[model samples]
Target chain A: MLSPGATIGVLGAGQLARMLALAAARLGFKTHVFAPSADEPAFDVCAARTIAAYDDPDALDAFARAVDVVTYEFENVPAATAEFLDARRPVRPNPRALALTQDRLVEKEFVQGLGVETAPFADVPDAGALARAVAKLGRPSILKTRRLGYDGKGQVAIRGGGDLGALFRALGGAPCILEGFIDFVKEVSVVAARGVDGEFHAYDISENQHENHILAETRAPAAILPETAVRAKEIARRIAEAEDYVGVLAVELFLVKSGRSERLIVNEIAPRVHNSGHWTLDGALTSQFEQHVRAIAGWPLGSTARLGRVTMRNLIGDDAERWPEIAAEDGACLHLYGKREIRAGRKMGHVTRIELE
Target chain B: MLSPGATIGVLGAGQLARMLALAAARLGFKTHVFAPSADEPAFDVCAARTIAAYDDPDALDAFARAVDVVTYEFENVPAATAEFLDARRPVRPNPRALALTQDRLVEKEFVQGLGVETAPFADVPDAGALARAVAKLGRPSILKTRRLGYDGKGQVAIRGGGDLGALFRALGGAPCILEGFIDFVKEVSVVAARGVDGEFHAYDISENQHENHILAETRAPAAILPETAVRAKEIARRIAEAEDYVGVLAVELFLVKSGRSERLIVNEIAPRVHNSGHWTLDGALTSQFEQHVRAIAGWPLGSTARLGRVTMRNLIGDDAERWPEIAAEDGACLHLYGKREIRAGRKMGHVTRIELE
Candidate 1:
């Protein structure tokens, strides 16, 4: 295990990296943040920061030399950057995990290979393939870019008749996957961490809500049955073990109910700290950020016991304008990301409220 | 109230300042740290740092210009430094609090003036004064410098007979205060905050244990009588109001029990976040650092509800060497200040374990 005073290099300078850096600091570990943006949120709190593009060889080399282990906040970190860092330092959650999750089709296949069920999907590499894929998945399926898609971006919802070639061209003819829609009662996720020793721990399930395709809120100990929660964690554990993941990974699942029976469907995977787990910051014994730090540092996992039932509401866009009122609200824990510009649908911050069970 | 993106200038670059900066960042505020030392712990996490003597006018002016308001980590911030910043920006807890708490005798008198009980104390300006003060306070009394004393420094205990002149010279014959020893059952403190709008909130009393005059351990919701805890908070509220304090303050008290009756004797006042209250970081709804930031920002105070029965043990010097074992210990929340050198009596880190009540 890396010693307490070891330096950690993080490859993103957003709020997730910001909280990860803060958590690393609490463990006597200093963090160096590397991102293209000069004034990202994590820059304000990290010990050192490099403002360079993902493909900058010199910056990546320096970052590797400066840290004992390299980790990242988002899955979209360029493949070449991860490979470069992996060659020098230990890149946690490994480059393979990144490659698997970076492409939606590859990720779905990987899960299916492990005997886990996923939303029915088909590969669409061209406009001609889009028609066949849509026919296989049926109408009302989602055509999403296989690579570099996040927060409901690079997606085209196929409902009624439209120009299939126009839709494929709209996404720049990028490799895509058509995912069949599921009649899920709720969307839930399991944020789990795996140690270098192969030990795995998962937090309680989080029920997620979305607005405009962006995460709106998350309630933890998600109102799912106990058996379903256990099954969801088992699936996440299996995925982590299969990937040889050595840090936090989140598995999003669709909680579907048919009559009186309920089951979980594997939806997607996030290779780092997930927004659905933000409730753990205030509602769990050990926060997901701290857990990720520990796992990447090769330290033992901490307790994932929930403190209570909690709800986390994301403050998006102009929603952050109510921060003053939120601060005044009793028992409401407010967090605001230091983002200067408020663009539409941008996540500005979050507030969590916990009710002890 | 200062807006979320405002920059807060913290005057001392220590663990307290580092924690305050982290908390400020969580609320979308930035922090600039000012300290004389170049490699202080707080510098690693602060948005900016100014390494210069506290009395350097140019550095002080530049720092003031860079921040929205000024607050500090310790009570012994030089009087001139506080005054200089006061002239340029709004200084939380005000300069008067520094003037009052910097002198032990003055603080005792202020507590007494507010109809609160305090240990009997006498001022010693010279050898003659020392003799008279020792006679009035009696043997086993502690003679501490009136200015710049902390963590048992600049203190001499008078037990039995000794050369009075030598004792005076031992302390450099500087102004001092002789406090009569109290036969106390325990040492407890109320970590409280006062908002700019005069709103007051206090956390549950923390029972403190000292090793070599440095805080060794603290357990919240101290074992004192319920009424004693309420009375202790009342005393702190009275003191904060008298000082018109904005930001967190700590009131250390000696819980004395006699004939089944319990009462508290005021021991000392810390105008900033106190070491005894560090457990609030994970054991309370809102940490003391966040409370200080909220109060100084003119924001409403957060809930001070304790999470459970918690114990915090300071990892002094080499005690931090057991971090690996502590990491494996379930539910032990470790907080290590990023200090490289570990010296005897230096507070290197701490571990907190919480048990839900």
Candidate 2:
């Protein structure tokens, strides 16, 4: 088990890594962020940082030797990088969890194989396979790259009269998955954690809203049927147990309402802290970031009780310009990622509010 | 007004500066700590730090030129240091406030001059004056050095048959104040802030318990009479206005319960964040550290609403060894100063817990 003064090596240096570093610091652990960018947001607050590329062997070796454990901020860490670090130090949510979530087909298959419901999906390798998959999944499906897709990127929506051959060629004939669209009443997720002792704790379900395919808001204690929420928690538990997950995991679900009945379909599993869990910063007994640190350190799981009715909103782009106003407001907790520039569609910060009823 | 990208120069490099830097970073501001200690705790988290004595003019000039404003973690900043920086950048809480609080006699005089009640005090310069003052004030008076005293140091209790000359000689024979003891019920403090725009916000009073003259625990929404708490707030407001203070200030009070009626006597003012206000980190809508940063930056004061019944306990020396257990607790928020060693009576970290009713 990693102790309080141990070092944590983070693979990426984005906002997630920054928040994780801050959380780790609060737990008496130091963070060493290794990223190619010179001024990644995470570097600003970390105890140590190496401005080196992921493939830089010397930097990776030094980082691994310095830290007691390794973790990645995002799922796109190269397989070779993970293997290299795993040889030197413990890397978790483990390389297997990363490998499973890095690809679309593998993730869906793994979830479904665990007796969990997922959206119907078919692999399309070429034009002929695309046509076959189109016929099998119907025209109103999304053709997403089997790898490297995030925030609605690297995916194209197919409707009636959309050319299958042209669409396949447009995506450069990369291996892809065709997912049949589900009429989701609401998008919800369970941000849960598995401790080193295999104890699982899940926060209240969070309902998410996406604007321009980017998360806009997340509300905890999601206004979903009680049974559906329970089922969502169970799905997360089974997935964590099946994977032997040792850190925070987020399972996104599509809630379908039918005649006063609710059904949940597994959308995806994120093997790291989820944006929807941001509300935990102020609205829950323990934040998801802190939970992730504890789980990775082989510590006991903290309480998952929601403190009050909580709402979290992403401050995308210029929305962060209202920080002065937000900071002045009562009960508004504003967190700004120290990003130099605020580009369009970039998440600059977030605000969390807890309302006591 | 300093903007987000501006720099803040801090005088002290202790845990308070470490916390202030962290708070400033959250608002996208960089911090530059000027301290003589090479192993200053704040150096690990700040963007820049200068290692030189406060009297080093060259280092002070460079530090003052590097930041947009100046603030200190403690009130003992040499008057020359404050003046040197004040000529270059704005200094919040102003140097006069520091001068007033740095000496026990000056602080007592200032409070009484404002028509605020304080423990009856008399200037004691030598053995003769000490005897005379004790005779006038009666037994059980506190003889404290006028300057450079903290955490039970530089003070001696005078009871019947005590060695007055030896006690006076032991205290370095510096200027001192002899304060008559108050038969009080509790020690509480009001932490409040005044923004540049003249807006004032105060967190609820916190009941403080001291061990060896160092703060041990603080409970927010102090168990005191409602009118007495209001009077404490009013006294703080009056002091802030009198000083034209533009940042957080803490006023310690002695609550004397005589019959069903309760009255308050001013103890001393901390021209910066007080240890008693540490509970605000997790117990209030806005933490005292963040509020200080905001007030110093000429921004809006955040809400001081209490989140719940909250308690903060300082972890001194070996107490920090319990960090692992504290981290595992459900709602406990533990914060450790990145100090290297845990010397006896040294404050290494603190933990804040908010209890929901």
Candidate 3:
């Protein structure tokens, strides 16, 4: 078992890593953040930090020697980098999980193979393949890159008679997945954690709303049937148990209304803490970041009890400038990523409110 | 009003400061920790930090110029130090509050003058005064220095028929307070905060236990009569309004039960967050540290709702070695002060557990 004062090394020094470092400190563990960019956000809150390329062997070696276990904030950790650190120290959520999540096609197949419902999807490698996949999936489909896509980036929409060949080239002709759009009433997610000892814990379901494919707001106890919520959690539990997941895993689902019946179709899996789970930091007994730290440290899972009726709103870019008004609001919990600039589409911070029933 | 990106300057870099920095971050405010120690716990988790002696004028001036307001983790801030920073920027809880709290004699008189019940106390400057005070107060009393006393330090107990002159001379001939001991059943505290606009909020009373004169454990919703609890909160409110305090304040009280009747006597007052209030970090709707940050930053006070029956235990010195075991507890929340030594009597960390009724 990991003891207090032991260091946990984190790859990717962003806001997620910054929060993870803070959580680790609360549990009596220190954090060492490693990122390629020197101006990474997580550096400000870590006991130690290294600004060097992921391929820099010397820096990686030093980091490996310092921490008891290594974890990543983002799933895009290079396989070689994971292997390098895995050879020197233990890596939680393992490199295989990273490989499975880094590729969109593999992630879709993996979810479907687990007997979990996923939207109709087909792999498209070329213009011919795109046309054939579109024909199979029908119109109003989303074509997303197979790798390294986030925040509505590297995605194209094929509405009815849109050109297939130009669309393929527009996406750089990379391996992609064509997903049949679900006419869903809302989007929901289950943020859960699995420990090394096979223990499972899930927070309450959150109903999410998006603007331009980026999360806008998340409210807890998703407006859905209790059975549907149970199924959502079951899907996440099966996936984590199947993979022997040792950290927080978030499963995003599309809630489809079908003639007085409701069904949840898996949209994607985030093998780390997700944006939808940010509300738990102030609204639940155990926060997702702290849960992740507990899992990797091989500790007991915390209570996932929702404290009250909770809602979280993302403060994107310039939206965070309204902090003064929000701070003046009664019982509003505001959080900000300590990034220096206000770039468009960047997640600046969030505010959570818990109403007593 | 302070904006989202405003920086807060905090003096005294301990676990309290670390928690304050984290709380400020949640409100989209940055914390700049200034302390004389190079390896303070707060340094690892703040947006910025400065290392310099409290008496260094240049460092103080630079620190004051960089932040919107100044606050401290402890009440030992010297009058000159607070004045230097106050000249350059706004200092919350003001220097007068600090000066009042740093001296036990002043604090007792201040509380008593407000029509609040306090242990009978008399100032003793020399052997003659000591003899006279002892003759009036009688045996079974406590002799404490007038200034710089905390956690059982700088004080000695005078049993029945003890030497008054020798004890007085041993106290360095400094001004002292000889307080008649009260027959109390339990010790409790009310941790509250006052916003800059004069709004006040208080957490529920916490029953405190001491080991070797150092705090060992605190349980919230202290076992006391309903009226006694109400009086405890009322006393705190009156004190806050009287001082115009704009930060967290802890009022320690003695619960006297001499039959069916129970009464509360004010024992002491802390101008900052108290150890007895640490359970709020994981057990209340708003932590005392976060509440202090909000109040000093001129934000609305959060609800002081306790999550459950909570117990907080301090890990002093070698007791911190049990962190591994503590982490393995299903519902225990652990916090470590990043001090590098295991010296006896040092507070290393604490663990809080919230039990649902």
Best by lDDT: 1
User: For residues A1-357, what per-residue lDDT tens digits would candidate 3 score against the true structure?
Assistant: 787678999999988998898888887678999999977668767888888889999999999999999999998889899999999998988888888889889988998899888899999987899989988989999999999999899999999776799998899989898999899999999999999899999999999999988999999989899999999999999989888889999999999998877898998889898899999998887899999999998888887888788999999989877777776676777788777789888998898998754
Best by the TM-score measure: 1
What number of clashing residue pairs does each candidate have, in the order they appear?
A: 0, 0, 0
Which stretch of 10 consecutive residues in model 2 chain A shows the poorest summed lDDT? A21-30
Docking model 2 quality class? medium
Interface DockQ of each model: 0.85, 0.57, 0.53
- Model 1: lDDT equals 0.93
Question: In candidate 3, which residue ranges exceed 4 Å CA deviation?
Answer: A257-261, B169-173, B257-262
Q: Interface root-mean-square deviation for each candidate?
A: 0.8, 1.9, 2.1
TM-score of each: 0.99, 0.97, 0.95
Candidate 1 chain A: 10-residue stretch with minimal lDDT: A258-267
Model 1 chain B worst lDDT run, 10 consecutive residues? B164-173
Tell me the tens digit of each residue's lDDT in model 1 across A131-158. Answer: 8888888989999999988898999999
TM-score of model 1 (CA atoms)? 0.99
Candidate 3, residue A142: Cα displacement in angstroms equals 1.4
TM-score winner between candidates 1 and 3: 1
